[model samples]
Structures are given as C-alpha cells and as structure tokens.
Target: MRILGVYLENIRSFRKGLIVFPPRGITVIQGEVGSGKTSILMSIAYAFETPTGGRVEYADAFATPQPRHLLRTGESRGLIRVLVKQGNRLFLLERVLQREGDRVVNSGNAIYVYELLGEGGLQVKPVLKLRLSSGEYIEKLRSLLGLVEKSGRQRPEVFTNIIYSPQFNLTSILELEPSKRREVIEIALGLSRYTDFRANVSKVIDAIGEKVKGVQLELSRLEDTLRSLDKQGLQSRVKKIEEEKARVKRELEKVVSAREKAEKELEDVNNDILKVNSVIQEKRGLISRLQQENRLLRDKINAVKSKLASYTQVLGVSLDNLDEATKKVEEEIRAIQQRELGLRERLNALITREKDVIAEENRLDAEIAMLERRLGEVESDYREKEGIVKKGICPVCGQRIPHEHGLRLLAELREKAAKIKEELEEARRRRGVVREERSRLRSEIDKVQAELVDLSGTKDRVREAEKLLLELKSLMERVAEVASNEEAIKRMQQEVESLEATLREKKEKYASLKNELNRLREAERAMSNRLSELEGELRTLNDQLQKIQVLEEKLKSLRSELNKLVNSREVVKKVADMVDEVSRVLAQETFKFVSESFTTIFTMLAPDKALSIELSKDYEIRFYYATEKGRGLVVLPSGGQQSVASLALRLAVNQALRAISPRLKDSTLLLDEPTIGLSRELVARLRDLLNKLDEEQRAHIVVVTHDTDLLEAGSTRVRLVLREGATQVSYEGELDKNYRAFVESLIEKPP
Candidate 1:
C-alpha cells in the first residue's frame, strides 16, 4: 500500500520528473524552499485519489475571469502517473488534463483516466475517455491498493490523511467536534463499523423524519380542503341532479324532433340551390378560360399590326431590300447562337454550385447529430448527480453536505447540462440556416435550367427566319401597302368577334349565381329559426350538468385525502420501528467493542501514566489526567506533552488499523513536522521514536523536516534540489536488483 514511484509532467517546479521509493523502508524527501518536495506527494495524491481544495499547483495556467483553472503556465496539459506495488502486483494509475484551445472549461477536471499494467503485465487501457465511469475503475484501483473497506473507516480519507499530512491538518483535527473526532478515530483505528453503521442509520432516521413531517403537513392541508367542501350536502344534491338529468333529457328529445323535421325541409331547398350553383361554377370556369384565349388573340393582332407597319417602310424596294433583310436575319441568328451558348454555360455552373450547397447541408446535419449526442451525455451526468444529492450525499466530495447545499450543487450540475444544451441548439440553428440556403440554391439551379430550354427554342426560331429571308430574295413581288394594311385590320376584327362571344357566356354565369343566392336566402331563414330554439334549451341543460360535475369532483378529492391520511400513519409507524431497532443494536454490541478499543489505544498514546480515555455506551469521549477529567488536552498547559500524546494516539490508531487490513503491509506514515513544540531535550526521544519505528517494521515513516537534526542514521533520504527552475531527486540506496528475483518468485508461486 505504499507508492513505489510518482511521475509528474507539467507540475509545479518540475516540468517532468519521478520520485522513486525503496521497496519497503523509510524514504525521506528533503528539500529547500521552492524545491517541490510537497508537489511530489500532491502529485501522487492527485493521481490516485480526488484531492479537493483549489486547483493543483501552477493551475493558474488555465486562467479566465471566471474562477476555474486546470493547468499551469506554459503547460497545455498535465499528467500525474502513480506506480505502486500492492501485495505482489505492480500497477499504475494515471490522471490526465484536457484543454480547449487555451482555457479549461467544464465542471471539475475532465479526468482522462487509464489503467495500466507494469513491465511484466498485460494491456494498458483507459477506463474514462472524457468523464468517470460509475465505480468500476475506482474499484479496480482500490483492489490493487488493498483499499477494501472491511471497516468503513479504512476508506480513502483515513489512509490518504496518514500518508499526506500537512502542518495545519493536525491542529485543525484536534479542534474538531466530538462526532468529527470520533469519525477520525474510527477511521484511523480501522474500527469503523460502529461509526459507519450509526451514520447510515442516522441518515435513514433523518430522511424518514423529513418524510413524515411533509406527509403530515399534506394531510393537514387535505383535511382543511375537505372541510371547505360540503360533502353530505353535495351527496344529497347529486341525487336531485340525477333525477333532473333524466327529465331534461326527455324534454330535449322533443326539441330534437322539431329540429330534425326542419332540417329535412331545409335539405330539400339546399339541394335545389346546389344544382344551380354547380351550373354557375362550371360556366365561370369556361368563361375564365375563354377570357385568357381572347387576351392571346388580342396580343397576336397587335403583333401583326406592328409587322405590317415595318413592311410599309420597305415599299417598292424589291431585290435590294430582300438582300438587306437576309443580312440582318443572319446577324440576328449569330447573336442568338452566342447568347444561347453563354446561357447553357451559366446553367451548368449553377448546377455544380447547387451540388456543393447540398453537400454542405449534409455536413451540417452530421455536425448537429454529434452535438446532440454530446448534449445527451452531459444531461445524463447531470441527472446522475441529482440522484446522488437526493440520497443525501455530496456529488463532488462523496460526503453528505447539508440538505440546502446539496440542492445548490444539484443546480450547478443542471446548469452545466444546460450550457451543453445551449451549444447544441446553436449548432441546430446553423444547420437549419444551411438547409434553407440549400433549398434556395436548388430553386436557382432549376430556374437556370428552364432558361436554357427557352433559349434553345429562340435559337431555332432565328435560324428559320434566316432561311425565309433567303427565299424572299430569290422571288420578290410588288405588294400594295394599302391591301396589306386592310388584311391586318380584318384579322383584328375577327379577334374582336371571338372576344364578344366569350364575354356573352360570362354574363350568363353571373345571372345564374344571382338566382341561386335568392333561393338560398328563403330556405335558410326558416330552418335557422327552429335551430335557434333547440340550441337555447340544449345550452341550459349543459350549464346545469357542468355545475353538477364540479360538485362531484370536489367529493372525489375529499375521499382521496382520507386515503392519504391512512397511508401516512402507516409510514410513520414503520419508520419509528426501524429507528428503534438500529438504536438497540448500537447500544448492545458495537458500543462495547469500540469502548474497549478506544481505551486501549488511548493508554498507548498518552505520555503520562495517569491519562486514560473513557467512553459511554452512547460513544461520548472523556479524557482524564492524574487528578482530574477534561474533554481533551485543551485543559493541559504543556504544549510539548500534547504534541507527544497526539503523535502516540495517531500511531496507535494506525497500528490498530494495520492489524485489521493485511493489505496495508508496511503502510506509509507521513509527517510534515511532527516534532514541532518538543523541547531540546525531547529531540532524543524523537530520535528514539524514529528508531523504534524501524525496529517494529510496522509501517514506513516519511518525515519532511526543515531541521537537519531530524534525519536518521541508516534511513534513505531523497534530497530535492531546485536548480535552473526545475526540481531533481537524488538518492543512492536502491534500484530494482530484486526485479529478477521477484519475477522468479512469481513463476514459483504464481500469485
């Protein structure tokens, strides 16, 4: 359960480095100011466990106006790889940082997680791509580290605090409340069954208490609501309404009969009107088509008149005029050929551009799909956090926060998902705009195609005109201008005659509509009179039915409220029974076991012979000296003895913990400056303490000391030197000479 080596990249004071440990002995990390000795432990903790306070060292590298940072300056990403030998197996736990361009955005670190086997093992695989899995990866790491919670106190916090203690934690822990102190004690001693079981039972009691209060409040409100309605009076009224309902239905049937007779008479009249209207509609359609044909004839007449005027300009010109006309027609044919060629080229170009637009549209659709999936995952994570909070636990710390604070954390999770949804919406809108642009592009391409067709027809007409002009030059006749003009006038008069006939038919359709309108008016007036009478009576009946329905709903709600009261009473009783059972178990078995263990540990840790700890069945702790009993060392005047006693208690706790979990073989004990406040004379005692620690070979002690006097004679010391803005580690005690020996042992025993 000790870290063999820690590899850090882009961490504070060290761009890339490793701090290696001896297989199973004390390895002290000593360094000057700014040498990153603390960073090594931090990196190890960060790699394998969740370290919460602020960001990691040099984290201001991912600075925004917002209070979020993930990396250090000059670092785009960071890595902390912790390699450990748990029992007989070597494993590595890696944590990675991700950055977006320059800034880190999201709630918490986007843990790039992986599980890797060492030089002698299998595959290296990442458990998390962008976010953590439930507990699978954590369980894998804990198993390798032997972090099984046989007692709940042996959880991450217990071992982590022992292995990575800073100066402030010691004093802060001493001043904590009794319950919190008890939590630390149980965890440190590996006797967490009572504490953990009690906490869980307390949570259940609290949760059920809250439910009972809410349920009782709702019952009170339901009773008040029930009182507001007259249930007995409403029941009597219901019978009267039912009788009246039948009488009204009978009277309504008679009115319905009168309405039906009137409807039949009206139907006969309506049929007659429909026949007339049908003929009118048909005549109108024919008139509309004839009007359009007349317009075409008028346009043709005007065009002929214009052509006749042009011919008048060529009076008496014969062969010379024919030659000019032939040349002009040829010129027109060449221009048409050039215009059509340009138009066809434009049509082809537009078609190609339209295809590009369609491709863009498809790309937008794919991008939108990806964004939606991303949003779904974010929303799913948010939902999971909400559930965790409802179960009375903090999502971030894995501890239970206050009820109100947990809800606030739930809101934060939801907001993160909302931000993802906002991004998804933005992508979808862009995709929508692209789709509309694609549609418009398709329409433009269609127009270009239609224009190409029209131009081809124009080109053919120009070529025919050129041939006609050539024929005219070969045979010319001396035509009279007056006669040509007279022929044009005759064609116009025939067009006028056709228009007049179509106008006459439209007038007949208008006359038929007028007659049908008169007949409809007469029949509609008589039927509407009877319809109104029946509708008035029906409205009255409906109003009464609605009133009766409102009362019936009120009665139903009161009955539902009565049922809820019964259910709530049963729930309160059941919850009370559970609370009593758990209390009884704690009072009987767990309390006696912890009381015995606490007294034994207290005796070993205290400096004075008179000091001892006492515990009640309720788990209340009282400390005593030779003459008096106090709550803790707070009443003691001597700081030196207090430090010694605290250390003893801490060691005894760890030893008891070690006895429980064999996997914690040679478990680590980290001290920032545990010898602080000790007298000059006590320096020898401290040295004796270190020597005694090695003699027991019970745990590995790593002390970071500013005082050079603290180092032991034979223990390994890792001197951390800061030079050229980087921290380097130097130690000359051991390498893996036993690597081959250990591997052979594996073949022999195969564990």
Candidate 2:
C-alpha cells in the first residue's frame, strides 16, 4: 500500500494542511525541527492505526503515540484523511479524534473507509461507514492493506515495524536485548510461525506427560484396592448378613401386626376421650351462663326495690297511693308551665318596642344636626353681608349698592337663623320623648325577666314532683318484675344443678379413656423399637453389596485409561521431535537470508569502514571489523555506526518481508528522521540507498528529515516551514509553480 495524499486538521502543529505524494518515487520531506514534517507521516499511519483503538493486549505501549498529544494544543477535534493505493484500487481512510473530559478519544462513528469509484475517482462508495466502532474500522483497513493474517488476526507490527519506522525510532530494534531483537526480527520476517508451532508442540508434550503420570498413579491405586479385597470373603459375609436380616424381618412382621392392633385401640380410646371432653365443656359453659344470668337478675331486683322505697319517701306516700300522687304532680307542672309562657311573650314584645324607640331617636338626632349646620351658615352669611353693606356696593356685580339693601339682607339672615333655632328645639323635644318611651319599655322588659326567673323556681318544684311521679310508676312495674325474677331464679338454679351433675359424669368417663390410651401407647412403642432395629441391619448389608459392584467397575475403567495414556505419550513425543527438527531447519534458512542482506546493506552504507554483522542460530547480532591487527569484535560503536547498523538490519528485515509476502513487496517504506545522529557521509550513503530502492521499485520510499543532502535524492521534493503557529508545505521541483499558488491560497484561508 502506497500513500498518495494526506489531509490534516488540528493535528499536532497543523491547523489545516494537505500533502500529495508522488505515486512511485523517492519523496523527501525536508523541514526545520518542529515544522510538522513528521506529522504528515504520522497522519498517514494514524488513519489505519489509532493509539487507543483496536485490541491493545499485543500492542507496544512505548512505540505508540498517546492520543492526548495527537490533537493540536487548545483544539477540541482533529482529523486525519489518507488516500492510499493498493494494486489498481484507491481507498480513502479517515479517523477523527475529539476531546472527552480530561483526555482525547477517537470518535468511533466518525472513522470511515470509502472506495474511490467511477472515472477520475470523484464518486465515492462506503467500504466501512458510520456507526461502526473504531476497532472495526481499523481492522477493515488492515485487511484492505493485506496486514491481517489468514487466522483473522491483525498483524499491526507488519505495518508499524516494516512498512513504517517512526521518528527517533529508526535504531529501536538494535537497542533491544538479544532475545527481544530476535523476537522482533522473526515477527517482521514472518518466521514466528515455526517458533510458535514448536512452542505449542512442547506444551502438548508436557501435558501428555502429566496425563500419563496421573493415569499411572490411578492404575496403581486400583491394583492396590483389588489386592486388598477378598471377593470370596465378601460374598460369604454378605450371605450370613442376609440370613440374619431375614430372621429379624420375620419377627418384625409379627410385631408390626401386634403394634397396628394396639394403635387402633389407642385411637378408639382417644376418640372416646375427645367426645367426653366435648360434652363436659358444653355442660360447664351452660352452667356458667345460667349463673351469670341469675346474678344479673338478683342485682336488678335489688335496684328496683331500692328505687321504690326512695319514691315513697319523696312523695310522702306508699306504693299503693302512687296514682294520686302522680296526678297531683302533673297538675302543678302544668300550672307553672302556663305562667312561664305568658312571661316569655310579654318580654319579647317589650324588646321589640325598645328597638323601635331607638331607631326613632336616631332619626331625630340626625335632623337636629342638619338644622344646626344651616343656622351657622346663615349667621356667617349675615356677617359677610354686613361688611358688604358698610362698603355700600353690590357684592355679586362689583358695583356700588344702597345701605338699605344691605340692611334688609342682614335682617333676612337673622330671621332665618331664628327659625332654624326654633325647629332644632322642636326636634330635641321629640327625641327626648322617644328616649323616655324607650326607657319605659326597657323597665317593662326587666320586670318580665324578673317574673320569668320567679317562674323558673316554681318549674324546679314541678320538675321535682314529676320526678317523684315517674319513680312511683317505675315502682309499680318493678314490683311485678320482682315476682317474675324470683320465678326465673329458681328455674336457673335447678338447671345449673343438673349441668353440674352431667359434667361430673363426663369427667369420670374421660379419665378412664385417658388411662386406656396411655396403656396402648406403651405397647405400640415397644413394637416400633423392634421394627427399627431390624431395618438397620438390612440397610448395612445392602451397602456392602453395592460397594463391591462399584469397585469392580472402577477397576476395569482404570486399566483402559492407563493403556490409552501410554499410547498418547508415545505419539506426542514423536510429534515434538518432528517439530523441533523443522523449526531448526527453517530458522537456519531464514537467518541465513537476513544475515546476508544485513551484510550487503551495512557494507554499502559504510564501504570505507570494513565492518560486517553476523546472525547466529539464536538470532544474536554480532558486529566484526577487520584491521591491520586481524579481525576484532565491535563491542561498542559510535552513534553514527549504531544508526548505520540499525538501518541496515531494518532494511534487510524489510527485504525479507517482501521476499516472503507478495502483498508486501510494493508496500511503502516510511522513514522519519532516519538521518538523526548520522554523519554527513552516512547521510549521503543513505540517500543513495533510498534512490537505488526507488530505481529498482523495491518500495515507495518516503523520508522525513531536516537534512538538505536528501533533497537531491527525491523525484518529488517537499519543503515544510512553520508559519505563525501552523505548518505550510511547498514542492521543490516540476510541480512547484503549479502548486505554489494553490498552497498559498489554502494557507491564506481561515482554518
């Protein structure tokens, strides 16, 4: 897969940028430090690989960039759109990142992959659309790029380790320990399958050995158990127990029959006792009820007699003279009630008359007040006219007036005042008369109230007489009820006596039944104990018979399992030997090719320095240099040499990947700051190496660097500069003029 172009928004230091790469050539991306040159390469990788997306269990934490730092500072959202070409197909991969709480997260639904369709690749069709999780979108992209294995598992290292080498990580593989380096090389070259297979076979061998041990132990245990058991003896003992159990069972049957008879007798006795108890309880309840009734009747008779005596004393008569006394008391009550009625009527009339008087008096007072106001007005008018008369002018017209006219006005005002005074006097006299009448009515009301009070006293005496009369009537009725109560009392007493006698007879019968029940319960207990003892013996014998049968079956199963385990162990050992041989052969062949390629690349980059590297059967990398004093091992090298050696090993591994997988032959080689810590001569050699790869079309080489030496190596050269706070891009060769205006126009526009 080759990246054709990349578009970024708010990614790292870029607010808005677009980088278009040549289809197949060495493209050198040159820029100052922090000019966002590496961001363009990162954007391409980010489209198919998110820092936090996908299955992270197999991912390298240090190698992956943090999502929190991917977005531009002070930005809430970022975008990475990459257009890639594989074979004749064009795919556009996009990934979006957004701020969530305190961290940056990928927008799952915003990630998409679309196939560029139709002519000119203008029309688009979705390959992986919205609503899909970010992991799903990334996996789909990996499949499209042929970065997924046949087992439906993702091989992200193929893209990250072989296809792309991130900034400052060009020599990362060389810095790892020997074992880790071997592991990385194997995975990159697709040789880990053989190692993995050997590992699995070893595990299988160990498991088979454990199974064999377990089976052997179980077989030994079964043999020991078989030796300990004596079948003849067990059979003989079981037979003896059976005979004894049979004898006991015969006796138990006879006892059970006897126990059943006893239980039946006990149940019959219990039933009889229950019946007797029921009859006794009924008799006791009846007697209690009759006794309570008698007590209530006696209390009522006493109350009635006491009330009759009180009435005789209050009325000054005996019970025989009750009629006359009641009649006299009723007449007195009637007389008192008549007087009360007359007084109430008179009092009500007097109250009504007082109300009328008060209303009339109020009216008189209002009229008198009105007259007094009129009189005062007239006097004020007369005084005002007198002053006008002295001036000898007409007050209304403002003209001179005669003195006689003024004097006449004064006399008229005085006369009006006198008349008002007389009328006010008359009103006052009338109001006084009304007040006097009100006072007389009130006096009459008070006198009637006094009379009503006197009547109330008489009413109290009448009420007393009426109470005596009511008592006299009650005494007569009570005397008759007294005779009836005495008769009922005698009857209830006789009933109580009869119930007591019946209760005593039932209690005696209940006692006799209880004694019989206890005797039968004792006999049943004895029989039940004998039956339980026999059942226990039979249970013990049956258990022994079952145990012997189970042991025989288990012995057979153990023998079969032991034989199978022995055969499996042999087969597993053979398979392990075969896998080991294969792994050794494959490892030799793979390492041979990788070591040869490493030697060739390292020599080409450092031809003057007689340095060479060797790959051992264990995947150990050893560097050797020849001098006048024969050959010496390169124990420690300078930064430049280390970079050269690391680059050589990485390129050799890339070659191995291409040689093994046809799909990876045309994959892009992304190098970020590969010239970092390298000498001037080494940078030139690297430039030549990259150009040779491009010439042979081994891969599409894309390099991000700050070295100007690499500019000549690129067929498509691009320059990045930090402008204001964003990155700006410009091409350096044939397309410079054409893209300059377009790039400037883009930068001039708002982001």
Best by TM-score: 2
TM-scores for all predictions: 0.41, 0.48
In model 1, the runs with Cα more than 4 Å from the true position are: 1-15, 20-35, 41-108, 115-122, 131-164, 177-525, 532-554, 580-611, 614-637, 648-670, 675-726, 730-751
Tens digits of lDDT, candidate 1, 1-751:
6666666666777787766666555666777767877667556545554432334334211111121232445666776666565554555566555466756432233233334457644323444433344144455555545563332221244543444555434443344566766665555544555445556656765665666566566656655665676656656665665565565566556655655665565565555556545554655555555555556545654554444344334432233466666566677668878887887788788778778877877887888788788778877877888788889998888997888998887787678778877877887788788778778877887887788788788767656555555444332331233345445545555555555565566556556655655555554554455445545555655555565566456556645654665565566567656756765664454445555655554454344576665654334444556655543442553665556555554565566556656777557776666667766546556666666667776457666665556665226777888888888877745445464344333222222
lDDT of 2 by residue, 591-646 (tens): 88888988888888988667767767655667788899998898987787777777
Error of 1 at 729 (Å): 2.0
Instruction: State, as a TM-score between 0 and 1, how close model 1 is to the true structure.
Output: 0.41
Model 2 clashing residue pairs (backbone): 393-401
As a TM-score, model 2 comes out at 0.48
How far is each candidate from the true structure, as Cα RMSD in Å?
A: 25.3, 18.6
- Candidate 2 CA-lDDT value: 0.71
The most accurate candidate by lDDT is 2
Give me the runs in candidate 2 sitting further than 4 Å from their true place: 45-63, 83-93, 109-163, 211-569, 609-625, 730-751
